[model samples]
Structures are given as structure tokens and as C-alpha cells.
Target: MTQSASPPNRALLELPQVQRERLSHIDFKLYFLGELRRTDVADRFGTGPAAATRDIAQYKELAPENLVLDNTDKIYRPTANFVPLFDHAPQRVLTALSRGFGEGIGEELKPMVRCEFPMALSEPKMSILAPITRAIHRNKAVRVSYTSIESGRSEREIVPIALVNNGIRWHVRAYDRRRKGFRDFVFTRMENPVLLEDSPITDEEKVDQDVQWNRIIELELVPHPAHPRPEVVMMDYGMPDGVLSVKVRAANAGYMLRRSAIDCSPDHSLSGPEYALWLKDPLALYGANNAQLAPGYRNPRDDSENKPIKAL
Candidate 1:
């Protein structure tokens, strides 16, 4: 009875929900990188030969122009006119090959990629982050036991508004009710959060009121006057004419500059392999709207009107 209801002539796109998603990955690998194999489809879905063959037949029925079987290799190859029905971001494709970190795809689901990249292992646990994610979506307050070098350990309730990645780590941009101000709480430092559904969330406590986060600062940088190999420096950073202009939120400007080893010195005299670039407009990231610098951040522009603050 069930077999009669669902005929063999079902539309390719009308396959069951889970199989459609699996086919999309096949489409992505074939169209984007031209490396889709029957084994890739088999491994991706944990299905044997018969099911994978059926999926391929379904896809071929739907889009015959997109892919053709290579009789020589006994594999499917993308046609010249191939178009992607899945994600096409360059970084997304590159990171998928990085293994274990591609969003939404699991480590067990994907085959091991051949390429290697230096990736840090530090990451927050899903259990600790789940409650915070829900609170952000629901506009609810959460209480967390946070540990920081400055405060040691303490419990506080905060209204989480946004999650920010400051290159190296994730931070929660939340209004700290205990401190009566907005603060950046490192995500990994927070533990065992309790979501407060009844707590009143106000617009004033959201990102709109985060002064440093809202302010944008421009940094004009050129090859360090001290860099002996100026041409190599340009190639190293993929910068043309030896100048790179970057805009960052005022709150994260310090971390970005420090990480890039950009000499913020006026004289551009900071010498070493570290100082391969120097800021052209050294004071561009100073106090926002003429207000004080963000907490714990020291402005090099404030220290020396004539020279850059030392990089050591």
C-alpha cells in the first residue's frame, strides 16, 4: 500500500527532508571543487552503494546539465555550466577542509581533508553556551559565574545582547547589572549560567548604548620605515602600494593593532621583525567622541606626542 502511494517517479527535489540536505552537499562538492565522488556521497550520509546510487540518479534526473559521469574515472564530474545550490563562500569551502570546525556540519559526517592549517583548539563547550544563546535570542537576562584575572571569581546577572569575536576569542556584549554598565565578558570565562525569563530587558541595556562598540575607528598603515625588505613585506600581507587601511570597532582596536604588530609610534622607529608595519594616522583610534578610553586599554597616542609607544 505504502509503495503504491510513493512512486519511483518522485521529483528529485521532493525527496525526504534528510536526503535532500545530503544531496546538496554532493552538489556543493561537485559544482564548487569538482571533487564529488560516489564514495563522498556514501560516506557523507553513511549509506551503502544502493542508496547513494539512487540519490545520484535522482540528482541526474533533476539537473542533468550540471554534472556528467566520467566513464574513464567511473565518477561524476561537474559540467562546464555547473551552478551551486548550496553555500558558495570561499572561506566556508576552505574551512570545510579544515575539519571539525565548519558550522552546522559535524566532524563524523565529513571525510578527512588533505590540507593542513594551524588552528587553535581553544573553544567554548556547547552545554555552557546553549543557555546564553537562548537568552540572546529571547532577550532574557542570565546569571553567570565568571572568572577573570581582574576579579578572580564572581557571580553576576547580565542582559546579553550580542556575541562578538575579537579575532582570538568570543565575548558576550552584555549589560552587567551588578556593575551598572555594559561590559565584554569572555565567553569561556563564564560558566553555569541561569537564564532569567522574568527579568525585564530594556533597550537601553542593548548594543545601541555600547559606546565603544558603536564607535568605528580608522587606521591607516604603511610598511614600517624600518622594514629592510619593503617589497617582500607588501607580498607577505598582500597589500598593494604598501598601505593597508583597516576599520575596527573602537573597543577592539587595541587588540587588533597589537596583534598585527603595527607600530603606532609617530617616529616609526620601533625596529624588529615584529614591527613590519606602522600606523600613518597614529591618533585615529583615541578616545571615542572625546570620551575616556575603554577600560584597561592604554592609548599609545596618549603616551607620546613625538614617538610611538614601545612594542615590547
Candidate 2:
């Protein structure tokens, strides 16, 4: 979260308060210049139009020679003489320089990890974004050519209604005209997209408001004393000692399990005879691993033929 410095309440904190007030005034002035109309300026500052008008007049009085009236729009604008006072290009340049230096250090420390995923910029891909944004804004239907992994062929005339990002990829949430229901289309798999002139689909059952399809997995791994701790993995929520556990929300449980294999070092031990894999919610699996088992505790997988009992 980004936060601005708070203003002080007493004389002892006068310096900081004055600095905050000055910064706030500069921000408001820039906003007024960019937005033009006094109504827009007043709306931004949460002040009445009369107060905004008075402030504009006072600003012009202080810098009489630095204000210019826009005849076309019947609005006042700041001249070149006043531009230097509000210009933020120097601050932006400093911010870019700082970010570049920090990214360089991060790249050196983690050579194998890429900061962001690569997205291919093809003409069809670029063209889809505009219509998708428009469809989202207008709440209309869009026709698109999409490829399906199961079908192994490109299908045309799919109606898309929403756009979604699943961290690693982008997808379009749409009502399939052929299937007569909602489906998700991967952006990379879309070949061609065209806006449809037909009326938007209005079936309530087909619209999905909650698009996130993720399940949380809590895994408890006991590391061996000999093996060093995993360095690259993020342990946002964990308990250290011999036991290490994490709550990972994932769209694909198998993919997450495969990725977590790297974090479980060779020296770690299992906690139970048949690792205690408990599914908190039947719809999703949530489980734990153990180094040793309690005597006479039956393996959870023994009764279920489909369940795979294996080491982390």
C-alpha cells in the first residue's frame, strides 16, 4: 500500500504539517491543470465549486502573468512560466533510475527466476483487447475464433462477455453460442476476435460473477536437520523447527504439488506411515505430511484404490 505523510496536529509537528499541506496543494493544482473545468477540480478536492473558483482566482492574482485563457474551451490554463512549478518529469526520472538499479540487484541474486511471464504480441492478440474492453464496458456479446485443446481445431463465433487474469495467463469468460453455456477461452489460444452486432446474451445462469477457480492446499513438511532450508521459495505463512507448512491457493492441485516438489529437500522425513492426506473440503484437497506415524493408525489410502500414497 502507498501512503502519503500525515499532517501533524500540534505546533511541535508544524514542519511536517506544513510540508504535507504544501504537497497536497501542489497535487490539487496539477489535478486542476490536467482536468480543466472548475467542477472537475472541485470534485477531485472534495470542495465546493465556489471554493474552487476562489482558489483559482487567488492563484491567478499571485501569478497574474503566468495564466492563459483557453478561448476554445472558455477555461484558464497555466502558461510556460508556471509550468516549472508543477512539472514532475525530474521526479519520474529519479524513480525510474532507482527501480532500474534495484531490478539489477534482484536479477543478479536470482538468475533463474524471471520477474514477469512473457506474453506474445501478435496482431490478433492486440486486436482482441480493444473489443474485450468495449464488451466489458458495454456488457455486450463478442464473436471470437478460439482453439480448443480437446478438439484440436479452431472454432469460430464464440460469444465472450468477461475477461479474467489467472496470474500466469489471461482468459475470456464467455457464453459459447454452440455449447449454449459459459466457457473460458485462453487469450493465447484465440486466433481471431470480432465484435458481434447481435443483442447481448441475458441468461443469468450463464453469467459467472465469481470467476476465480482456486483451491487452498496446506502442506506440512518435516525437513531433516542435515539439509539446508529452501532459499528461493516464499514462506509467507510457516512454522519452523522440523515442521514447515504452507497454504497455497492454486487452480490446479497437481501443478502446485509438482512445483512444491523442489522445496521438499531430500533429507526431509515423512510424518506418518501413509502420509495423512486430509481433504478439508471434498471439492478441494488440503493435507499434511509426516516423518513418523502413530502406532496402529491405518494408512488413509489403504481403503481407497484411486488415492495415491507417496512421499512429498
lDDT of each residue in 1-312, candidate 1, tens digit only: 011111233474467889777777777777645766777777767889888888888777776767888888887888777655544466766666555323345545452466766565557778778888899899899989998776688999998878876567777778899888877788788888999978888777777898888889887878888788888888987898778878887767766776667787667766789888878766685674322222223356566333332211
| Candidate 2 lDDT by residue in tens digits, 1-312 | 112222332432343554433333533343333324566446545679887676666545444644666888867665544432233354543443333322235445332223443453432356767787676666676666666766655565555556655435567766666766555677777756667667655664244532233335665544323333432112422433434555653333333443233223222242332332222222223232211121122334545333343311
- Model 1 C-alpha RMSD vs. true structure (Å) is 8.6
Clashes of 1: 1
Pick out the ten consecutive residues of candidate 1 with the lowest summed lDDT.
1-10
User: Distance (Å) between predicted and true CA of 126, model 1?
Assistant: 2.8
The number of the candidate with the highest TM-score is: 1
Question: Residue 4 in candidate 2 has what lDDT?
Answer: 29
